[model samples]
Target: MPAEVDLKRYSKRFANLKSKKETPLTARIQIVGIGDDGLDGLTGQARQLIKNATVLVGPSLLLDKIGNTDSKRIVVGSNLQQLQQAIKELGDSSAVVLASGDPLFYGIARYLTETFGKDRFEVIPHVSSMQLAFARVKESWDDAYLTNLATQPLDRVVDNIRTAELVGLFTTESITPAVVAEALLDRRIDYFTGYVCENLGTPDETVTQGDLQSIRTQSFGSMNVMVLVRRHGAADRPSGSAQRRLFGNPDDLFLQSRPKRGLLTPSEVRCIALAELSLTPTSVVWDVGAGSGSLAIEAAAIANKGKVFAIEMDAEDFALMIENAKMFDVPSLVPIHGQAPEAWKELPDANAIFVGGSGRIVPELVSSAIKRLTSGGRIVVNVSSPDNLVAVQQVLGDAAMQPDVRMINIARGQYQLDRVRFASLNPTFLVLGQK
Candidate 1:
């Protein structure tokens, strides 16, 4: 039969069947996950439900299978709203929604249930792409860290991945496997074996495996799953190295410059100032007069996924900032080598600002930086001298919105040989203001 004739006959048959069944049909919805092998991949019950559905909806790629449907058919590219509307319009009819892989594993089942209530539909899940990837690789994913790059920040994902022996990630356009590998390589974390499983569970399925260095120079197809397996004994040495029980970290971790040796803000003071800054994972922060960038570096670690702009006027400290940022694996900390207030121009307003300076310009710098703070933002100043404190308090106290101040006297215990002695790093005062 001719193609046009077949379509006409098919439509007539559907109309005839509809007229014969005059009884009111019960309204129902079914979400089905189809694999690369198409409908044959479906289970017995799932296939039967799809075959008898009165209305079918799915992405254009999946809709090709039921294109000859005698019932209503809708092809959606990416408009989820249109799909929802079509589902709503298919009231009192047996409607089936088609999706790729398992519908519930990071799929549409969750959204559909949330949007239309759980009792209104049934979901038939299939083999998820992650399961298939693991099967192909012959590896168990019982302990692997899994996350979606599409919804999470790449920096955060990389940060959490530091301790994982194995990781499985769903990559987005901006965070492809190559980009992820590059990020890891930049942090000197290059001991993982990388793999990209493309077109999984299909005839043209291709799995490309390589080390982080090799993967950093490769490309992958759109449909793929990224996996990372850290080599044995390749995990971060001296585990819990990032965690600090006390307020201070070992001074050696920081990239310190000579002549400015003691100028680096002690970690004890930096900890209190950071806490006063009200740091959060998403907070935008600035560290002015960031000597050796110690405060900003530690602040960056505390605010893992947040943005930290470390502005330093000294040339040597600015260079040290970059080295410290790399050592800490904090890609979000930006080292700005210029004077404050003027250096912060063109950047987004900060949610928190930390000022550490003993210079004569402390008062003016704090006042200028405070103006760029967002509403409800916090400002913390660490000043050692009583004169600088008085100067800053005078300006801040007179501002339209004045901040609260506190004096922090931190003392640490030192044990040399068999004798124990108390060593006071500094008696720095912290002033906190909110806008």
Candidate 2:
């Protein structure tokens, strides 16, 4: 049959179907993921679904690749609104929508499901190009950070790449592997081995591997996936101190002990706690329970000319704190390797103190530390539980110091497969009082 004859027959049937007054049965839309290999890449069940579909819908590129089909075809472009209207006009016709790779992973399936409803469509996924790219490079993607350039800003993606161990990116024509490589180098992030997999699952498939500097100088096919693997044991290179802020640096910049990485106070919470302390250039500060010395190091940076002592009971954490202080070049920061109170017994009274820990003895520690606080100095205690918050508040109340209490709830935005989602941090309670 001629292509025009098929279109006319399809149009007339669609018109007659739409003119009926009675509502038709719910449309069955099968969204099938295809690769560059076209029908050859599809499974038996997926190919059968396409053959049985009464109406076919997809972008021109994908529709062109499918060749001849008995189903009536609707060519969709970037205009999704038109696609939705066309699907609606089908009026209960079984339609098959073709997409590239795994439609759910940064593909069109999410848009279709969101536009219609979950019950209206069934999704059959093919191997995503990201997965193929990782496979080509012989790397695991389970823990890799994956995202699309179409949805996220390049600068934000570069920042995220700075701290990630592995990354898989869906590249657009305008934002190719070369463009991403340039952005990373501009930010002084040069520890990754880059791989650009092009035309995956096809006869013309090619995988290009190079360093960021080399990748930045080369061009690649529009259909490509960019994968970055951090070089083994490569530590993150810090930006020049002149460009760094006095406080609120990214948490990744600090070296943290494994298995207890969450022990460090989050950067957002650290900023708030530091503000509450209100230290001066010449003020003395103490960080009690300073796991990894995040708070004490930032404090030393703020009080550049002042002394900041970080007290930790864990030997490993204490060593990490010392290394972190050196990493940030904060000569004024001191690491005390002992339990608090006893650790600070020989040190001078501090103008500001930050206590961060949980347990029944936290309140007692706060009570004892306050006596060593200089007159007119502030003490800020950060606890994760309500019980500790109340206990610390009661201790301040007994010392005749009215404490200002705050509960901080923080949620950070992170890129998932296709979109950005918020991940909430554990809530923290901060109690600040003056001696």
lDDT of 2: 0.88
Q: Candidate 1's residue-wise lDDT over 130-234, tens digit each?
A: 888888787898978777776677776786576577788888777888999988877667778888998887788999999988888888887888988877644
Candidate lDDT values, in order: 0.78, 0.88
Worst 10 residues of 1 by lDDT: 237-246
Q: What does the lDDT read for residue 304 in candidate 2?
A: 88
TM-scores of the candidates are 0.51, 0.73
Q: In model 1, what is the error at residue 376, expressed in angstroms? A: 42
The TM-score measured for candidate 2 stands at: 0.73
Question: Which residue ranges in model 1 land beyond 4 Å of their true spot?
Answer: 1-26, 65-67, 237-435
